[model samples]
Target: MRYLTRGLFWIAVYLGLALFPCLALLSGNMPPGYGYWWDFSLALGYGSASMMAIMFFLTARFKRPALPFGVDVIYYFHKYIALLLFLIVAAHPAILLATEPVVREMLKPAQINRYMAAGVVSFLLLTLIVVSSLWRKQLNIPYDTWRLIHALLAIAAFILALIHIEGAGYYINTPGKRLIWPLIMVCWLLIQLYVRLIRPLRLLSTPYRVKEVIKESDEVYTLVVEPRQHEIPAYKPGQFAWLTMFYSPFSMKEHPFSFSSNPEQKGELRFTIKELGDFTKRIKEAGPGQTVYIDGPYGAFTIDRHPAERGSVFIAGGIGIAPLRSMLRALADRKDQRPHILFFADKSLEKMTFYEELKALPDQLNLQVVFLPQHPPANWPGETGYLNREILTRHLPAHLSELDYFICGPAPLMDMAEKELHAMGVPLQNLHSELFDFV
Candidate 1:
């Protein structure tokens, strides 16, 4: 069923691209002073090229796996095609001007037109988005701020391009062609509106009020929120949710924080967040009675989906301990006596997100927590340094190959863990990982 859905998605994507050119070619009317046959061919190629660019951006945002292939490969293909489409679309005006003298006249200041203006605006916006994204770190623009700007600019570019196409009356001459682009724009707009606005408003009614804030460390703070309404949905151990504070969806600045408390306990939902970025850094100042909106429970990084007979190993680092803690607490509440080992890595013991809560879990659950510190304290007895192959082999169960490993951490740490596991002969299927960042 999953394969079938993916296949249909790709088919629809290809069909959408094909339809753009087909519509332009079969318009049955050419722009003034251009040969009908020539105009039809040019319009067909231009439309297909534009649609290809659109598809590349859309697919990159919402990744879908292809049959017998990895999602990573599809993403690379999308990147390459996007670059190709940019070149094709960029040369379109030059080609038209060279072939049709009428287009050259339209480019003149006296004949300055809406289509030409929109085309220019679209190109500029695309250039800004692509360039800023590619060099975001080098340019020193933060991810959150860049994301907001990127979304706004993308919407503006799409609107301008759509108006250009409709107002030009060349390819979109017929009533059908005119209706198609507007309908597509309206549908796209509505989806964004629902995802960004409508759904968040619904969450406002069933609020989760902040009950308490526990300061685990200088930077790490754990927030306990109790539902004011009747019932809050019980999520799986490792699942995450989008949390919004102070009723501002336009703040649209929601972050995905893992649940640190047990899911079984409906008394209060706890989230242990580290002061990392602009949004999270402010979490320390949040007090009791503050209203928060949670739009989740998303992500598939839990033990509920995959039951193992042998045991489970959770490898986490820094703030990555949020989900792992939730899993531990949930298991303890259920009294499921399964052997679980937690390999938590951090710069220092003081920076650990949830130290006390983790220590208390062993009494109620069958678990062992191993903290790996880069710089251990004067008389620290726990493991030190990074989580390399030696550290994993020492702490891991004897039947490591039979165990299911769940790893969550920084990109570099996660990569190292996966490599070490693979070197130790763990099957790829048995190893699961979740990346926090979308990029």
Candidate 2:
């Protein structure tokens, strides 16, 4: 129900943006409908520009509004909607170039005006934004640097688009039409300031000091930090937070990591980070007493919210087990008797970070741990190789569809696991997945 309400709110917001140009036209000084194609092209341009502006608000990581839909889903929406807006906005000029000879004439160097030049520059920037984002990893751009560039390009493009519209003075000729755009501009600026300035300032004041760094595996480490002045925000098991360490929150370098500690344990916060990126590679260097800023407790992939579930099946690959460990530990702390099945995948027994710790969980709670290693010793007697339909069918309880399944892993493994579970009769909604690769 909460999800439904949030969905409706976003839908209404989008509908309002789509209709804003039409509303402006109705306020007088309204040019007669220039023909269906011309009006539609202009409307598409206006709507797309509005969507581009709102993208900032969506990715700002506002906690309350993002509660219903997980931040991962929000990031996915941000990526796809950006593509859609680009297509729509491009159609505006394509139609104009094809239909109006005057537009084609203005395209030539001698006939071009400053307004048309601005529109052309804006279009090029928007194109760059879409192309760079879609191929960010392929382009070999660092995530932090890419984010800063993306934001700057988007803001500049939107501002130039508004200027082009004002100079064109076609649809936005009336007093009300002029007022509408300035109001929207004000809102956009406020959201930008809040995300880039106000929120970071708040996090700066509520600083956390690193208490310890525990090596979980050769490639994985747990960075534990405690609050210096304010108490850490209470969070549920299987959720994640953005951590900014050895840098200012405003530096735009914060990275998200899942909480690996039991949430019931207060004051100190633990993040399980793998040496996957530039920032994460230096995690081991972050010693005790280093100040860190956190902006999170986000994500809905948690077992606490669904207490009614009779049991749970957890599927994890590599460091993806971080969040699931938090859930298992919390259940053990509570002495809950609910049954759980953990299917943890790793490359080898020696490299498994929490192998012994997980083995101890069965004594604390009704839990069963299944280890799947890609390469096993000849003498090994347990399951080996990748998790497949056969392995899942043999181990999963007969009432597989009745229990909730949580999967967190690399993209390829997650894709395979989800398909296999569905084939084995698990309902779609009963299976939840945590995708950390937002880009």
Candidate 3:
């Protein structure tokens, strides 16, 4: 019922955005239409512009608004929806140019007006934003730098698009319609201030200090930080937080990591990070007393949300076991008697993280661990090779389809596991996965 309410809320929000321009147009006198295509172009332009404005709201990380749907899903929506809306915005101009000779004439450099020029520049900036994001890894753009660029480009494009719309003066001719654009602009500005200034200020006031950094494996390390002044809120197992180390909260250089620590342990937070990205690679060098800022407890992957789940199946690869470990520890602390199954995979036994801790879990809770190594030791007796249908079917309980499957790992592994789970007749709602790679 909670999930349904959230879904419905988001649907209503989208419907409101889509119909905003139409509502404004109807509220007051509308200017003369340039036939069907031109009028259609204007409607599309307004709708797409509205979408662009709301993109900021979606990514702003407002806790209450994001509580319904995980922030991770919001980001994925922001990414794909940006692309779709960009196409719609692009079509706004394309239809005008293709159908109207006046628009084609206005496109010429010598004859272009300021309004036309603004629209052109806005389109170009939007194109750059999309291309850079889609090819950031290939283009070798640093995550921090790319994020800064993305924000700036989005702001500039939205501003220029608004200018183009106001100057074009077609649908927004009346006093009420004119007031609407500025009101929307103010709302966007407020959201930007909250995201960029206010939230960072709050984070700065409540800082955390690194108590220790423990090496979990050759490539994975556990960072332990405790609140310096204020007590942090308790996060659910399987949720993640953004860590800003050796930088100010306003620096925008944070990286997301799962809370590997038992949330039952208050005042202290733990993140098990692997040497993967540029930021994570430096985690090994981090020492005690380093001040860090955290901005989360976000994500909908927690088992606590599904209180009725009798059993859970956790599938993890490499460092993806971080969140699952938190859940297991929480269950153990509660002395949970529910059946729990874990399939933890790594390249070899030596590479598996928290080996001793995981081995001791069965004694604490009704748990079973299945360790799969890509390259097993000569005398190894457990399952070997990648996760496949045969391995899952053989080990999964007879009530496999009824169990909640929590999968986390590299993208490819998660994809394969989800496919296999579906193939084995698990319902979609029962299969949960977190895509933590948010830019």
Best by lDDT: 3
Better of 1 and 2 by TM-score: 2
Q: Candidate 1: which pairs clash?
A: none
lDDT of each: 0.74, 0.87, 0.89
lDDT of 3 at 136: 94
Backbone clashes under 3 angstroms, per model? 0, 0, 0
Native-to-model Cα distance after best TM-score fit, residue 283 in candidate 1, in Å = 1.7
Candidate 1 lowest-lDDT run of ten: 60-69
> What does candidate 3's lDDT look like per residue over 39-133, in tens digits?
88888898888889999999998776688778898899899999999899899999998899998898899999999899999999999999999
In the range 1-439, model 1's lDDT, one tens digit per residue, is 5545766787677666646645644667644646754465456445644564354245332324333123333445555655665665566665776677877788788887877788778768867877876688899999878878877776776677666666664655666656766666665666676666677677777788899988888888899998887488878898777798854755766777888877888788999888877778888777999988887676657877667787799999888888888887777888877898999999988787777667677788788889898999999988999899888888887688888888989989999999999889889977877767654
Runs in model 3 deviating more than 4 A are none
Candidate 1 residue 111 Cα shift, in angstroms, is 5.2
TM-score result, candidate 1: 0.79
On the 0 to 100 scale, the lDDT of residue 52 in model 2 is 75
Best by TM-score: 3
lDDT of 3 at 255: 92
Candidate 3, clashing residue pairs?
none
